[model samples]
Target: MSKRNFNKMDDDQIRGSSRVLRSSLAKKGGHLDEKFKKRKMTDLDPRSSQVRNQRGRLNQTKVKGTKSLAEKHVSTDAKKGKQGTKTTVWSIKDKHEYKIQLPLSVDTSISWITGCHLMDSGEIIMTDFYNKSLKKLDRTSATVTVCDLPSIPFGMCYIGNNTVAVSLGQKLQFANISGDMNLMQSVDTDHYCKGLTYHDSKILTVNDNSVFIHNYNGKQERCLFTYDSNAYFQGIAVSDDGQRIYIASWNIGLVTIDNKGNHLFTLSDPELNDPFRLSLDNHGNVLICYPHSNIVMQVSPDGKNEMGRIIKATDSIEWPNSLYFDRNTSSIIVGCGGSAYLYVFDLK
Candidate 1:
């Protein structure tokens, strides 16, 4: 073998010379040297090594399949180069310009507003866990006591035009409302019911850490799934298509489950402390109430990202525990757990 001097050649020139030599040998039908063939091949160009490393990183990110929790909460419109300074897309103002406060009945002092649902007739139905009663408030700010429950009510959701399902203790009660509330039937469960929602003609109830499904006629269906033992499940909501179910846990944050009881994902944030209740917007986004944080947040349907803060704590929203998106008026009805007033925000 003849030794070639390469000290004077540039990087690209050396690479080109090597390629030319290899091609010339191939044209002559010459075989590679045994030593050269036995040597481990390595990329000679730094750029080629860099490109290969970058591609490997991209493949790893694709395998992960989801953004990190910190990245998901960041605003998409934030400044690209700013490190530590993140500007939120949504802002909360103190003045109730787009908000309306409707007070409940003067005779009834609500201690904890746990559940709320918007009716087709523009009336709002709420459950008072401390008072052990369900109340209805009309559009005109007129309030009426619907009915009293045997135990503390935790969550509620609308089943039909005039039908509602409420979770009270270990029993799930389905009631019909006209001028007054009447209990149609009740289904008994093994655990105490804490949150309830209707989806795909089935009743989804959260009893302790487990979730149960039932029919409307007081028949026990299937115990769908359960969560972590340490997690205290508070609120539950189902998608309109009945393909997904969202649950709010005090310990582990918001969890998403499929219709067949498969765990999909969990969304937890340092800002989203104690997610208590859940509701779905018209666009199929998840709206969660953080009572301890005194804020209401809107998250994406996949539970991978937070859309924005719908209600901020500085906006005079005190301990909001329940959320109801009223499609008729395009508003959000916020029920406070520590306050007596209910706030309504005009959805923009």
Candidate 2:
């Protein structure tokens, strides 16, 4: 053999030699790359790109399957009254037994009872929109005008133990209702105020198509969100956690949004023909009153399902406008637009 000339070896020759050495070691079940030296070399090697792709697909399928199972669990648990599921507390089967008639006098001149709230003491407060008056009915059914508003009083909600905030056109009046209704202060808004609710120490008001959020002192913090003008926004309610807001419209059903003013979804069920006012039970179930349909429906928080009609038209519910769920009594107080009677239903 001639004198070895290692220095004369070209790049291709060196590479070829290394490949041969690696091939020999590989045949002996040895790995050449330090990164994968100790790894297994099965047909389904974890380090292989094909295996990784397969794993990714499997993980995706597993995630989807888990979500589907969770959804099914919610549906099944609703009927079973289990946690993580909507309990069917309100139902039509118990409708007739729970109906309590309001004690309004037959001679009362109240035109349209638009908004209402229930106090812990079992008192029902309401706004006579057409009469431009705030009225209260004690637990004994004795009704009286609490105070007269300058503009039409559309919506009202309790802001304090003995105080309430009433929406009157473009102004929100803070009224004290301890002994008698007295205007404490007022807050002005850019748009008209139709419905009002308090959440996270803030006042949420709605008008034609816009929702406005304001501080307790009447300062407009922001316009929460606006809906299409074709649909008239009527009733408003805020979730207990202040994370979600539910709005009722005339033509459209209900619109739900996050606290950050993001539109989450719309609930326009055929059963929710004319959603007027909305309320939330302790469990965050949506209680909606439909005037045209003369019915009150309980819906899931996600707006994907309607629990059922809590009070149906056949139950003698007519022109249901304002709705409130009383935690103390576990009852729903419904005020009508034209009728002098307020219907109370105790959930079983």
Candidate 3:
């Protein structure tokens, strides 16, 4: 059985390379923190931004909410849509969602849906890093199941057949989703495995400032490239043709690289300032999530400029931390941290 070929995250099947990229996301408390939830989810003023003056090839956007994202700051193509940024983009009518944080889990900490993928069956598979588990959401039936993991999972990339690869700090864990979620095997990594993707039967990973490619058996092929080693890297994605690769540079902004490990360009704009995760759309657009600002935006297919904000806080998107685009449904699945539901938007 062949796995679905994802558009954005080779790394979300975010398809990866690295040992040095580090994030504080894995640490969690045993109990829910009501105050922390409110502060993290809604404390940010989503309407607090404006279009910064355009400079060179990219424009700096300081936006707050969806409506206030300043559509004029984007390209001509993105201005055509009032869809992806709002709830109207969904192809499904049912909005009610099953809870991702399950009671059957050992860890009682508040749930955080950190990574996700849309299966060919229109179902969703998600990784709860805080809970140290995987969750399967059957949209049609409205049922959810959870499976425990050996360690905290970071990011996910689909391998093939009903199987996926999960990043576990120092290792890449593989599991099958055909039956009850089960761990199949794991490949140890000398570097801390953070953001990941699968391309051409190879695994690409990133951490610290380096990206590496590996085989399914965990043999390092070669290092792709490195960025400002000092800057933190989070999400990673690869194009459909496996020619272009994108990385979320937390402090700097969006960066694109070629398959041969050459730096193509770096998109540094205020809008992408705190980018967390990266995904791609059917059109080859790079979707980026900014938690502090609470928005989901995208870069044009060429990686030169932006299409526009696909999502804002107004769309019930509060601190969207991770994202995945379902080619089957032409929908974008958003993982909002500390929330009971995952937000879905249609690109159709």
Candidate 4:
């Protein structure tokens, strides 16, 4: 046999061969929809989630699948009490229970949004990760102003009465999130800090594959746990008592974690092709936007009460990147990175 030189092939050939290997490994018995039927040995089926292919056509059937999961998991707290009292928790088994739409004017490629928190004056504070800016929108005045930060802001959590904790690219910083976007203190880290949530006097942040928990005063306490490193992670939202954390992993499932970042539960819906951002309403319902299908899914924390499939969530929502819920008003806001729009869905 002659001596072989492996460097002779071009980049495409090498990549093509690697893709073939990955495809083979990915085919471990999960039956995808007809849309993902195999095409070639070297090419990942267009319907497969390779993330390298273009956005394919939305599948209404798949969207419905995700909706059913949400309906099945819808919170039942409301059923245990009075009915129709604005104070009563609404258990939605379908999207028809609430209104979904793209909000007017406010648009941008928002990597994330601070959950709608009313300031001391009743204004909503929102920060955009990709836009690298923060804004306080006056609910009564309808005026908006920007908040400046030391670095690119990724996440924000409204700390009780006045202040908000903001997560910087490499550290955790305190901002006058309730008033004037003031940088108070910061926690240094070695990983790329992406999301933050506050609970029970503790602040949690997601760093790459690991989750870091710190004291509210910006001091490193310890790492809660590390997850599968391959999961592409993003923003986070926490429940009221601070026991549950809702994690949004791009193209992955919606994961639940403890205050210390310990993985508690995961709702990996095969029909949920991608979940870019995540948020939980006061009713404990999860509102997610699936761009590929142009549908906004309102699911129960347990993945119940799914609405029929809709492609509208992907229509004008180019690159739906971030999602947040205004617990005060029960509204859902979605951040579209490409179209530069923040679509707000009123759930009153």
Candidate 5:
């Protein structure tokens, strides 16, 4: 029957009937604490905040369900704690940066950009394991050259004047950009490597287990330092002035080592999650990328005499693989493979 037809009686009859219904409902189980009563006994009430709260609590107690992430905790304004660095300043949001579309139609799954270095001729030398080639990008002419290599190239760094040392398939390959297609030297090792940088006349490489430092000429390989098993090292960077060497671990945070690879400090903890790549800004601040979370993190220098802010590109990146900070223009470049674009952010 319709509600209007059932309540066709006078107001007095309706009041009396509601009073009797309340009395019957109270006697059955209403006397007990509302919180302790079974939900089945509760009546559906659209305006009841109490019911909503109770239902939320009930769902939280259940273990097997898709849980929603806490929005406020990850919000941009939630917290900006000073970790011996300047407050993080986001200069670019996701999908808001400029993208440089590549003309090469290679359909390889690019894992990471690995390393970026500007040659003496102002060419951007980017290494990638996707095509197993040393790719050269002429920023001025907008031309890209892919050089075939015997194996995968993981990392590249300028060793001396024009020599670049590349970590390729458990070996170090040295080549001079000005010379012919000849390998100056090849240092063989059993360690799985990723990032490469040079400091204090030594070549630093991040192994799966630890960070190793060798002579710039690739003559020797020795363990300068090691971290706990918690850290899966990926990227390595050395300051131009020769004071710091920053190593990016998979998720264990960054370990700042000195010239000898002796641990100077750790920039992150277990709570920071994953850091896939590392780059140094012109001001010596450490720029990091969290691939799983799709965010870029920056850690300022110890002195914190930094003027430029820590900028992040959020919108334009879908799985940001690498980070490169151009000191001349003060622009940061992020390579996102899904979008197949490079995101650039400016910080002042």
Candidate 6:
């Protein structure tokens, strides 16, 4: 095995890689469709989130594929009331997190992991944009296996039966994670894709302003309402029942939309700057992060209440991104972009 260390490159090799990365981004920028071209890349600034703050409370949730004992939970409460009004009582606390070393097998480039998903089998999968590969971390043996991709990748989600769909810039590539990592199917999108999620048998992807919904067979189904460029949505999360959609907008805060594509509300916070990713715990609450700000927070199901801080800069989170609230394990899995550590937080 090649020597697998975080600092695999000497000074000269690191500098060369840095130059190549900048040039590559510039080349890709020439094809932007005006909307994404004008938007500020909030996630690329590693120092944006610099303040050290106290931790936020992570909302309580049930284990995936199990029953929730909390009666009239957050998801149900929204449906019982008017269109968007929701009263929430959050039962949350500071989560206990421990960083684990993910040894790489195939590549040595600085790992800019953009997405992570914990499978039902307890293995974790992630998309590394810097290395242009997909990696699977086996929890039992602490062994990692890799599958190279055809292009730079973005977000991804777990499709059933040992399969996952990854977001390429203009396409959605589905691959089987069971073995061989065979390319299963590819769905062409209407726009360059960023954040992606699967809900109600439909796949959802985002650009600077619009959310494109696609059918399972790679067909453009329908698009939700397109907000202005200020929306700057890149990360998305859907309620378990697929009724509410939470989009992370870098310019604004979280924007809530209903199933029929109506804008329910846009929730902004002064403390919120450049929100980048969104995930949901099993029970129905939303989880989001500011990569540059180095913080992760939990929000109520209706997108009205900010639950508490789940993680913060004081907790040693640096340039945090590629966040996933793993429903299978009922834990929050975080991959810090450009770092070697993968953090798994056990919810209290």
Q: Pick the candidate with the highest TM-score.
A: 6
Error of 1 at 304 (Å): 0.5
The TM-score of candidate 1 is: 0.68
Question: TM-scores for all candidates?
Answer: 0.68, 0.69, 0.72, 0.60, 0.64, 0.73
Residue pairs whose backbone atoms clash in candidate 1: none
Q: After superposition, how far is residue 323 of candidate 1 from its true place, in Å?
A: 0.9
lDDT of 4 at 110: 17
lDDT value, candidate 4, whole model: 0.49
Give the clashing pairs for model 6.
Answer: 49-292, 49-293, 56-309, 57-308, 57-309
**Model 6 spans > 4 angstroms off:** 1-105
Per-residue lDDT of candidate 6, residues 1-348 (tens digit)? 111233333545544544454343342422324344345543342322321122121221111232211111122212323334223422324453322322323453556778988766777788877566677776666565566666667788775557677888788877777743545556677687888887756678888898888765546777886896667787987787678989998788899998788999988998656788888766677888787667888888889988787786677756577787655445688886545557777665
Report the C-alpha lDDT of model 2 over 95-189, residue by residue, as the tens digit: 32111222122112323577877665666677765445566666453434345565567788776556677887778776666555555667778
- Which structure among the candidates has the greatest lDDT? 6
| Reference-based lDDT, each prediction | 0.61, 0.61, 0.62, 0.49, 0.53, 0.65
Q: Write the per-residue lDDT of candidate 3 for residues 1-348, one digit (tens) a residue.
A: 112112212221110110111112221232223343222221222222211121121111122221111111121122222233222222333233444533311323445666888776777888876556677777666566556676677788776667778888888877777645666667788777778877667778888578989786555677888885554677888877678999887666788889888899888886344787888765667888887567777787667786677676566655577988765556678886655566777654
**Per-model root-mean-square deviation over C-alphas:** 28.2, 32.2, 16.1, 16.3, 22.9, 11.2
Residue-level lDDT of model 1, residues 209-231, one tens digit each, is: 77888765535688898875867
Backbone clash count, each prediction separately:
0, 0, 34, 26, 7, 5
Q: Residue 180 deviation, candidate 1, in Å?
A: 2.2
Q: Backbone clash tally for model 3?
A: 34
Model 5 lDDT tens row, 227-282 = 86757677877665567777777655777777766777776544344566777765
> Best to worst by TM-score, what's the order?
6, 3, 2, 1, 5, 4
Q: What clash count does candidate 5 reach?
A: 7
What tens digits encode model 4's per-residue C-alpha lDDT throughout 252-339? 5667777656677776667655554566666555566554344566655544344333225334444444556555555555554323
